[model samples]
Target: KDTHDSLRDENVSIKKSYQDLSMTKASNSNVSSRAVVPEKPKVLAPGLYAMTPKYVPP
Candidate 1:
């Protein structure tokens, strides 16, 4: 359950980031703005996450 919750949060974060990227891409004017794209979150080792919270429910 904890893993599932963590994954869900990560997925939501990625989705929101993608949405933001799309909005920025649409409104950006300069052709060189492609370099401004946000970097993706890095994946850590198994049972650990780079972005996910560490709280677990009993």
Candidate 2:
């Protein structure tokens, strides 16, 4: 009976760690994806608009 109780405690601890790890990974991915998305529009908009003024006379 004692061994069974110990095994149950270990199982609960492992599950808790796994949940925490998954949450961390999910949050990190969200942050990275958000960071990459804003940069793309900033770069494209400036490059395209800056050339428009020069090309307008031709």
Candidate 3:
């Protein structure tokens, strides 16, 4: 019974730790996604400008 109780406690703690880690990962991904958004416009700008010249010449 004692061993079973200990195992249960350990399982709960492990689950809590995993939950915390998942939350941290989720928040980090959110931050990274926000950071990535600004870069997309910069990437698109160059492509648009490159195409503009080609279209203008034709």
Question: For model 3, what is the alpha-carbon lDDT of residue 18?
Answer: 100
| Model 3, residue pairs in steric clash | none
Poorest lDDT segment (10 consecutive residues) of candidate 1: 49-58
For model 3 the local lDDT of residue 53 reads 19
Model with the higher lDDT, candidate 1 or 3: 1
* Clashing residue pairs, backbone N/CA/C < 3 A, model 2: none
lDDT of 2 at 57: 32
Cα lDDT tens digits, model 3, 1-58, are 9999999999999999999999988766654342223322434554452232113221
Q: Pick the lDDT winner.
A: 1
lDDT of 2: 0.60
The residue-by-residue lDDT of candidate 1 on 30-54, one tens digit each, is 5443323125544476554454243
Point out where model 1 deviates above 4 Å: 29-58
lDDT of each: 0.62, 0.60, 0.59
Q: How does each model score on TM-score?
A: 0.48, 0.52, 0.54
lDDT of model 2 at position 29: 61
Where does model 2 exceed 4 Å of error?
32-58
| lDDT, residue 40, model 1 | 54
